[model samples]
Target: MKNGEYFISKDKALLQTETIHQFLSRSYWANRRTLAQVQASIENSICYGVYHGTRQIGFARIITDWATMYYLCDVFIDEEYRGQGIGRRLVDLIVQSEELDGLTGVLGTKDAHGLYESFGFVRDPDRFMKRRPTNPWA
Candidate 1:
């Protein structure tokens, strides 16, 4: 998807691991994540990257079986590029994409609930639960 000079792509080869690591490493949820861990995660998930020319500026990933449900996570837009609708467009493409059609979606966010809510996500505290791993990196 193209928006003016910025475009979004699922081309994993175009993903800049270092740039992604830089963004994720500073993000509240993934601050403790290592570069190697980020790389492995990217390799396993469907990754969406936003770019201007060749410089990557945003990213989001979905863990899905492409059958039943999908978990959207690690979403971010470069601090310099936040108000540009890049994050929304990136997510719009993901949720509206044929790959995730008709499947249940889930995500966790301490903030940005409003953003996701616009895309049809609602608070489901009663049914939602989490169990952190004993090994922090596991």
Candidate 2:
């Protein structure tokens, strides 16, 4: 989906590990995340990469069963690319994607509440649930 000079695509091949690793490693939520871990995460999820010409500018991913629910995470835009609506566009595509349209979506963010809220995400803390497996690092 082309919006202005940036385009969003659910192409895992379009993702650059260095970019994802760099941002995630420093991100408040995923600090010190490794490149290999990021690669595996991308490989297993429905990923969208936002690009400018040949360079990637942002990314979002959905971990879903393609049925009743989805968890959105690792969403970010490059520092130089912030303040633009690119991040919103990425979220829009994810929330409105055909496969996820009828499913419940959940996400955790210390900030950026306003961004998600605009897309119909409500902060119902009682609904959040998580359980870490022994091999979660894998």
Candidate 3:
């Protein structure tokens, strides 16, 4: 534990794919990520984990160029760990990091828009976009 109550750390190298897979499986939008995909994502992006006595209770990832743009993805908190400000702390650590300082952080959420809003995220009507991928296995 980092501060005697919450375990916070930014060590993707130590993340187990199985743990991440289980977390994403419970996520509302990302229940289909496979172990291989999760492993690749963890290896390629910056990831953070919140632990409760060695069990990962929350997770979040950011895909960024470290210069101009960032997309926050796959944020989830174990149902047992919700309502304790862990999610806020996770977001805070990411947004306040030097790696994301000058970039525009973006994320799409079906729920919890209010949480992101409290962290300065806003809906940009002009930034309309579309998804091009037709199949995940393609």
Provide the lowest-lDDT 10-residue window in model 3.
Answer: 1-10
Off by over 4 Å in 3: none
Q: Who is ahead in lDDT, 2 or 3? A: 2
Report the CA-based lDDT of candidate 2 relative to the real structure: 0.88
Give each model's clash number.
0, 0, 0
Candidate 1 residue pairs in backbone clash: none
**Model 2 Cα lDDT, one tens digit per residue, 61-97:** 8899887899999999998999988998889888888
Highest-scoring model, TM-score:
1
Per-residue lDDT, model 3, residue 33, is 72
Which candidate do you rate higher for lDDT, 1 or 3? 1
> Which parts of model 1 are misplaced by more than 4 Å?
none
Give model 2's clash tally.
0
CA lDDT, every prediction? Answer: 0.92, 0.88, 0.83
lDDT, residue 48, model 3: 87
When summed lDDT is taken over every stretch of 10 residues in candidate 2, the lowest stretch is 129-138
In the range 57-125, model 3's lDDT, one tens digit per residue, is 778888988778999998887888799888888898888888789899999988888999999999886
Models sorted by lDDT, best on top: 1, 2, 3
